[model samples]
Target: MLLPRIIPVLLHTKEGLIKTENFSNPKYIGDPLNAVRIFNEKKVDELIFLDIEASKLKREPHYELIKKIASECNMPLTYGGGINSVSQIENIIKLGVEKISINSSAISTPELITQAADRFGRQSIVVTIDIKLSGLFRKSYKIFDHKTKTTSNIELLTHLKKIQELGAGEIVINSFDKDGTMLGYDYNLIDYIKPSIKVPLTALGGASKLSDMTNLFKKYGLIGAAAGSIFVFKGKYRAVLIQYPSNKEKKLLYSLPYFIS
Candidate 1:
């Protein structure tokens, strides 16, 4: 079995890196470049820097900041947010980003995925789905629209399959309900969406610790284990503490049996 890549998911705004709860209530964390420098020393497997405000503001990614982060980062980086065109993808690649994640744009214009994949190769394209479960039993998928600033009525699995068909190399399932809760990931959501696409899938949001990642990887066999709060904060108070598991801890995590009994 292929070991899943352990990734630190960092949120970006005009201010800098921040953490959020349920995708709202933003709390300032630290500088993005400072975080990158720390992660570089830790030798993290990969990094995900998402510009949370870019899509909502309908602006291109902060290219200068991204370039700075990429230049300082030693590990492979995956950037998402405000990417809506082929030129943006080309430029991000030129800046040394290993992958480009398209969320709102993927839902708004799926052909962008195909176009990007055709030009940059499917392996470089990652589609992110920010979904929420609502109503009785909390069992429906809600697609949040950055353009309309509302939840879209689009069906969940249909969009997942569409992203796959468009030739994305990977899919990142980010949970709106679980964002920053750090209770755990939405396992039911993963189980529901697993069979719909063939590409590697990564789970994001609500991962508070290493075991959460290990359990998800063991249960779903994901290609990437990504989290934000667990790496950026410490303790129940959510104090600012950017940390990553040491190399020894990561090795132990990957060696665990497929099923922990």
Candidate 2:
């Protein structure tokens, strides 16, 4: 009986940790190291650190910073952005990181997924698919490219299956519109893509509250619930406060009748 994972996503720039709305207007949150130290105290299940500017700037991951974070992180850590080759993945893993997440590079070279998976094992590889709703009258979901900042003609389901077949161990579906919105998870998008994905699946963007996570678990059974804003902000004003559910809260969440055994 697999249990759902509650993960916090930390988006960072070279300057510091930041948060974005609709993938724009990156607001500085705090120091990345400080955030990690706090999450460590809270006993977070897993943590994801994405270099929001690495791929767009055409730079390699800040290995020194990653090494620091990896050394301090007490839980499994996944790092993304500007990861282009197996060497980079190996380097990140050697730094004590648990998983490597690829986005734009994977879009350009799908074979990298298989090669990295073969070299490091699929469990260490995660493929992130950023998606946005397009069109006028009837909006439809399309694959979004963070590097080009454009939607591709590729069908979403086709690409998902392709990534899984290419040996990706996990797939993270991120909503471009719901990013930083904190409204809720994109239930429709999950409904559409869940059936086609054979690998472990995680959903990011639009997770506002604990109920959002509970609703997601009730509906989907077993999946990774990853969020940025919900864990980093507090109160109606959205104050920059790093927090995670306490053990009591988590036990109650897991004890819900809808949660799978």
For model 1, which pairs clash? Answer: none
Q: What is the lDDT of residue 51 in candidate 1?
A: 95
Error of 1 at 185 (Å): 0.8
Best by lDDT: 2
Cα lDDT of model 2 by residue, 1-261, tens digit: 657889999999978999999999888899999999999999999999999899999998899999999999999999998999999999999999999998887678999999999999999999998999998899889999987888999888889989999999998999999999988888888888888988888999998777778766777754789999999988888899999999899878877654211
For candidate 2, give the lDDT: 0.90
Clashes of each: 0, 0
Clash count (model 1, backbone only)? 0
Go through the candidates in order and give each one's C-alpha lDDT.
0.87, 0.90
Error of 2 at 73 (Å): 0.6
- TM-scores, one per candidate: 0.95, 0.96
- Indicate the worst ten consecutive residues by lDDT in candidate 1: 252-261
| Model 1 lDDT tens row, 4-57 | 899999999888889889888999998899999999989999999999888888
